[model samples]
Target: MKIKKEFPSIKVNKEDQTIDVKSESNVGKKESKGKVGSEDMQNYFEQLNEIKKRVVHLQKIVRRFLKHVHVTEFRWKSVIGINDAALTGIICGSAWAIKGSCIALLDQNLKLKIRPEIEVIPSFFHAESKTNLTCILSFRMGHAMGAAIRLLTYWRGSKRTLVNKPQPLESKS
Candidate 1:
């Protein structure tokens, strides 16, 4: 008995341990139609209008939600430590808190104000007897908090607005 090999568009030889390969040169070329028709253009514009309508609806919903929702309290904290020698180090911690409310207007603008309270604590290992605590009321934390809240609110609102809507049925004539 002899072993035989075969493949589509290929020739294999087991006796001589050789294979023949073939490629079509016209495989890269495709026939092109003349031009886009008026119906195709009409369909494209209709789809665009539908998308615009959905976007407007989403914006209205977001604006309404923003107008009613308010942030009553916010807080953030961070700590850092450094060691200059094997037995000694310095440690520091800071925190900020803000309380406020905001309202979003019909023109997609926001009105907001916040009062922030900040605290800082520091300690040095070399000076074991010395530890300090400081407190202050400032406007900087208010700005930072406002920006953060706006960013988070818009992100969450956009996520909530993304719902799958049913596509219109097409008449297959």
Candidate 2:
């Protein structure tokens, strides 16, 4: 469909094939202009729409990244053999700082089992103010253990089977 546009000054000459489009000289025309074209408003809306789309895409990526981070962090903490209490403390701290909540150390079996041993150690030896050799060693071992556990777990997939308990022998008749 051919779209016909109307102009204030231009008249279409029907006699000839060539239409003479005219321009009324506003060359020295006094500006009685108040508000002009709505083009600016349309452009602003388009720009805002583009920005909204980008923001949504960025939010999606951030959500996915956070999910992976929380899962990996919780898994590593469990493997490191830190007691549930310590792990809980760490996760709580992380949650306070970051957006997503961390998984509780008590929720995992390994953290629940090992945390008692960590807690049993004397606080004087591993005081936060002073770093003793035992504390240093323990921290290093914990980090390494956590990393190793994470890799092992990843390799093993979802279900991990540890040592099988021995079956009790039946009494002879």
Candidate 3:
């Protein structure tokens, strides 16, 4: 006898700004473990509005946490292709070309790449290895106090954010 099992997976597509969650569950069985209750659902914008509010709150916490974060070292080395030298050369060249912009973007968001304490190093090796990657990233210990303070302060602020804006009525054509 063989047992049949399934796994769950979640994929995020940044370009499309969408998330795909896939899972196989025995919800229809006599005893279901992952049943969604009716009370957890809303008819329309209520759910989406609540989700939006949560996203905003989470973003605030992340930004506060990031403010406390500092990168001390970032190093990545990759070598592509073994049998085909042309492919390896092209990939290596492309990686080198994009390295500057990648670092610039990193610095723009983190604001630590250019600091004297940070060591940013990226390299492309054309040695024998179909695909190989070596990366080392070291960041200073981020204090959770800032994020905690921001969370508490947000709750103490005005209730304007909690007031759900009225959803625009849809036109019936």
TM-score of each: 0.21, 0.16, 0.39
lDDT (0 to 1) per candidate = 0.35, 0.32, 0.47
Question: Highest TM-score among the candidates is held by which one?
Answer: 3
lDDT tens per residue, model 2, 1-173: 11222223323345543233332224353222122124434555665555344343444443333333311111221111234557645654553333222224322312222322111121222323211111111123445455445444443324333333222111111
All-Cα superposition RMSD per candidate: 26.8, 33.7, 13.3
Per-residue lDDT of model 1, residues 27-116, tens digit only: 343222222334545676776555445453445544544554443332323332334333232233211221112112311333233432
Give candidate 2 regions above 4 Å deviation: 1-54, 66-101, 105-122, 125-173
Give the distance in Å from residue 23's predicted Cα in candidate 1 to where it truly belongs.
60
Clashes of each: 0, 1, 0
Which parts of model 3 have CA positions greater than 4 angstroms off?
A: 1-53, 113-143, 149-173
Best by lDDT: 3
